[model samples]
Target chain A: MRDTYQEQLDELASSLAGMCDDVARAMRNATRSLLDADLQLAEQVISEDMKIDDVRASAEHQAFGLLALQAPVATDLRVVIAAIHGAGDIERMGDLALHVAQAARRRHPQSVVPDEIKPYFTEMGTVGVALAEKAGRVIRSRDLEAAVELEADDDAMDDLHKHMFTVLMDSNWTHGVSAAVDVALLARFYERYADHAVAVARRIVYVVTGQMPGPLAV
Target chain B: MRDTYQEQLDELASSLAGMCDDVARAMRNATRSLLDADLQLAEQVISEDMKIDDVRASAEHQAFGLLALQAPVATDLRVVIAAIHGAGDIERMGDLALHVAQAARRRHPQSVVPDEIKPYFTEMGTVGVALAEKAGRVIRSRDLEAAVELEADDDAMDDLHKHMFTVLMDSNWTHGVSAAVDVALLARFYERYADHAVAVARRIVYVVTGQMPGPLAV
Candidate 1:
């Protein structure tokens, strides 16, 4: 009986890791769709988002099952609880990615990002993709060193977000208000995506060390 | 033992409702502070957010306790899990409120919102405060009628958000990029605050009717 329960616990961990992998793919594809203006790719990312949502739902369903049946306690219990929250953060990250894809789709063929801001978004996309990948590794390996580095990694995204605002605030900014709104919201999408990545990393750290990760590193 | 567990569940419900009250007040005060540019009120909102955070923490702590101790199952287990998610949504609402207060504090004396867009924000603030209060009632009373009204109410906020973009996109927008950024972000804060409230209402509906609320209608 104990062995069966242990296998179920292992199953939960693997499912969570699987969800993280989907999150990584979604972020990468969404960013590519936005930057490359590939409508087919954008459509793919948008459609596949339902799969990501399913992964989230299944993880939560499994969690609820574990709570009801096996009745996990102590650290086992915290892990289930944290899974509920962490799954949400990851799901929201997927939604953020979809928003990026939708933005690209909404402005199809027009290159929603102006020439002046394209490079910055390319950089932000790269960071978002990298962060999601890193989050996957952290979840899969529970690598303390990798988890520790996630916060500092997020700083680069924040700088990009701030730089975006600076560009919008610049006297020479001529992208017009429509483009400015696009730029602002898009930067926020990436910034928030990174925030969730770091949040998930914190949970991994908590599960491993039983100590909560400290303030988000700049 | 069953009666004791039921009482503990009731206590958890009360704590959640209390947290909702704080969320409502924080939204109301944060909007007032931003709209009125009342620095003192803004400061009050910012400082008091810690209390809101504390309430959320206590609620979650109790939930973890219940999960560990009583090992609640089925609907009881779902309620505890939902409370964890609901508390997070409420805490995030508080953070959204804090963001509004910080925006107000950051632009003290000089209104961040320009004259042309003030009416829109005024409307948004009114709608925001009303939604938060309504969310509080929905959580407390689990009033399905009130819950049913939430999505439509959020539509008002979304309309305000879209209208904000329209104003910004106006060819004649005289306000510089700085004001545009402010309007965009402040509008988002209010919009997101409403989203969380609706999310909480959905959880309430789920708890009362054992059916997940669809698309965030109150």
Candidate 2:
């Protein structure tokens, strides 16, 4: 019975890890759509959001079912709880992508984003991908070290977000008020996306170390 | 042994409920400081933030220890997990209050908020207080129905937030780029505070019903 329960838990973990990968892909593609003003890709992200939502629902159901059936204790309970929280974070990540895509669609032809802001978006995308990958690694291997490192990567995204705001405030940009709002919203979305990813990493840490990491300490 | 475990779980729940009450009070006080432009009150919020953080940490630790030691299953496990997530949301609520307090300090003697916007600010404060209060009640009673109502209240906040943006963009408020940015940031903060409150309510729903409410379905 224990072996079967463990196998079921492992299967749930694999499914959740896959969902995280899809969410990360959607985020990256959404960012690309924004920078490139690709409406098709943006629409694709909007459509794919339902799939991410479904995956999140399934993962949540599985976690709860495992807890009920296995009556897991200690470490197993921690893993199940972490999976539930992580699934929520991943679902939100998909929602953020949808937000970006919607914004991209609104700014269609003239892309509110200027050439100079590309690097910030690029860095955000890279950090997002890294965070998602690290979350998957932690889920698979229960690697506390990898989870800690992912938290550190989130700091880099924060720095980049600050820099992006500075750029928005710079007098050089002549796109006017609407553009500024767009950039601010976009920056906020990316920063929040990174925040959720860090939260997932933190959950992983909690699962392995049995304690929540301090914000400043991380 | 089961009785001891149940008693420990009850203690943890009581502690968490107390922490939620403190957080709710902090949120109300912070919004009051913003609406009244009270620097002293704002400073009070800043100082109280530390206490909220400490309470949050202690509550989380207690919950973690309960799970680790008792190894609760089924509904008990769900309750502990919900408490941890609720504590996190409450901590963020305290943080949001700090954000409003900082903004109040930045405004100084001359309130950036014009008299015409007073009604909107009043409404926001009312909604914020209501939401915080509802969160506290949910924590105490585990009342899923009240939580659902709080989720509906968030839609009212969303409408107010949208209205504020519309007002800012209108030709009437000719307050240059800086004022526009300030209003935008302030609106974002209030919207986000409401969002977090809604999240707390949603967790309550999950704890009771074992399902997430559909987004915008409120």
**Top TM-score: which candidate number?**
1
Model 1 agreement with the true structure over B95-163: per-residue lDDT tens digits: 988998999999999878887777887788788778777877776687989987988898999999988
Q: After superposition, how far is residue A135 of candidate 1 from its true place, in Å?
A: 1.6
List residue ranges in candidate 1 displaced over 4 A. A215-218, B1-3, B215-218
- Cα error of candidate 2 at position A208, Å: 2.8
- Give the TM-score of each candidate: 0.95, 0.88
Clashing pairs in 2: none
- lDDT of each candidate versus the true structure: 0.83, 0.78
Residues forming the 10-long window of minimal summed lDDT in candidate 1 chain B = B209-218
Report fnat for all candidates as fractions from 0 to 1: 0.73, 0.16
Give the per-residue lDDT of model 2 (tens digit) for B1-218.
Answer: 87878787777667766766676676677667777878898889888888878887787777757765666666787787777777777777778777777878878776656667768877886787778777777767888789889878988989999898788767676655555665677677777777877888787787778666786421
**Candidate 2 ranges beyond 4 A from true positions:** A171-173, A216-218, B1-10, B68-74, B105-118, B216-218
Q: Could you give candidate 2's per-residue lDDT for residues A30-112 as a string of tens digits?
A: 98999999999999999999998888878877876786566676778778878877887888888888898898898797685
